[model samples]
Target: METVTTRTVEYPADGLTMVGHLALPAGTGRRPAVLIGPEGTGLNDFQRRRADALAELGYVALAFDLHGGRWFTDPQEMLERCLPLIADPERLRGIGHAALEVLRAQPRTDPGRIAAIGYGTGGAVVLELGRAAADLKAIGTVNALTTGRPGEAANIRCPVWAGVGSEDPIMSAAQRDAFTAELQDAGVDWRLTVYGGARHAFHHPPVDQSVVPGVAHHPRHARRAWHDVLALLAECLPVAAG
Candidate 1:
């Protein structure tokens, strides 16, 4: 395996100190960057490993934080925190913008060419960031077919690709329809893919304990979603030669 550099960073967000993992590809020059968001439980090893994997593919990646660097193994705790955050778009935007600033400030990142991808609640945060009119090359989200404030999606300037499990109760048919409708109304380029026979949190690996009902891992679908996100990034945020 090619060596990649990794670091832990602390930043402020939503009146809390957030900690994230930053990964840089093994190279000598600046590269395209990606900001990663985690599920409702907050940033964990899974997201950090994703940043490391993206770095290996030549992109500077930062796995942004949520919940002030805490990971909730309890479903109730996760829900208590995430539900309110999701309902408040401004709070989500604050967290997303804080992470974006951290990613852009990295010496190895090509600030002008950056993308955002997130899972679950984190996915919603990226959408909120897009709605806030943040400049980004692309936005890819999984299991987060969330609708933002009315007419706010028009602020999104980049192509968006979202994925969800067909059986995901959290991202139901109505939610998907609303999400697509918002994008269409906003004139934003977007795509949605539903993985059959999967459930909510299908992109995640098996956990030691279940954090949410109806959330189960599907290895095949997880792999497919990762490839799809990578394809979205390649299409919209290709790394330039240094």
Candidate 2:
């Protein structure tokens, strides 16, 4: 494994002080970067570890925060905070842009070669960035097949990949259809993977904290989803070989 250095960074976003975890690879020189968005519950250990893992793979990664560095354990509290944010594209774009700026300002980041990946509400924010026509090499999301305003997806310049559980009630078949339709009509390259028998947040590890109904972790699917996201990065925003 490569030597990875990590740190906590604070930035302003959504009228709050956002704290993010940044992970850097061992080698010198600018490297392709990735912005990681956490679930609606906020930036927790799981997401920080994800940034570290990406750094180990030789990419500059920043796991950006939502909820202003606060992690909500209660499902209702999380929904109350995230639901409206998700519904508002401009707010989501503001959060994504703020995090992107922080990631780009890093000394080790190759700003021109960047990708955005997020989970749940965080994933929705990543999509909003695409809709806003941010300079992203690729976009990937898990359990967040959110549909943006009509004609906004035409601004997306890179391919998009999304993963969802087949049994997720929150993201139903109709919702998935709508999301895909928008992407297709916008002429964007897109792919969707449905993990059979899984529920919402299947990529997340099982937690002791309270969660909404139908939210469960599937270890096998989680590993597969990670592999898929890595493949997407390798193809779209690969770090240059030393």
Candidate 3:
């Protein structure tokens, strides 16, 4: 396995001093990079490990922070913060752009060859970034089949892939239809994958027990989704083996 190095980085976002985790592959040359976004609860070990895994695959990865440096173990608190943030596209864009700037400024990142992937609320943030038309190779989201503002999705310049559980209440069939319609009307290349019998946050491991009602972990689907996301990245970014 390729050696990976990681560090905690502090940046500004959402009127708070956001703390993020940056992971780099072995070597000093520029490489394709990814900006990772976490679930509503904020950036935790799972997201950090994802970044590390991406780095091991020769991509410079950064798991961006959502709620400053603090993670919410309480479901209510997470919802309180995430609900408002998700409702405000400008706020989501602000948070995402801050993290994107951080990733682009990195010495190891090929700024023009970057992708954005997010889970849950973080997923919405990455989608907002795409709607804002950030220069990206690709965009991927899980558990966040959010619709963009009218005609705003037309700004997206790259392909987008979204994964969600069939049983997720938050991303129901109607929501998925709206999301797809927006992408379609924008003429953006986008695809959606619905994992059968999986619920919201199905990609997450069963760690924090205090989760919102409708959240469940499906280990098999989680692994499958990870593989699919990796495939998306490989197709769009194509980092060389270390």
The Cα local distance difference test for each model comes to 0.93, 0.94, 0.93
Question: Tens digits of per-residue lDDT for model 2 on 1-242?
Answer: 44999999999999999999999999788999999999998999999999999999989999999989899888889889999999899999999999999999999998899999999999999999999999999999999999999899999999999999999999999999999999999999999999999999889987753446888899999999999999999999877642
Listed in order, each prediction's TM-score against the native is 0.97, 0.97, 0.97
RMSD of 2: 1.4
Better of 2 and 3 by lDDT: 2
Show pairs that collide, candidate 3: none
- Tens-place lDDT per residue, model 1, 118-191, is 99999999999999999999999999989988889999999999999999988998999999999999999999
lDDT of 2 at 231: 97
Candidate 2 Cα deviation (angstroms), residue 6 = 0.5
TM-score, prediction 1: 0.97
**Residue-wise lDDT of candidate 3 within 105-223, one digit each (tens)?**
99999988999999999999999999998999999999999887888999999999999999999899999999999999899999899999999999999866644677889999999
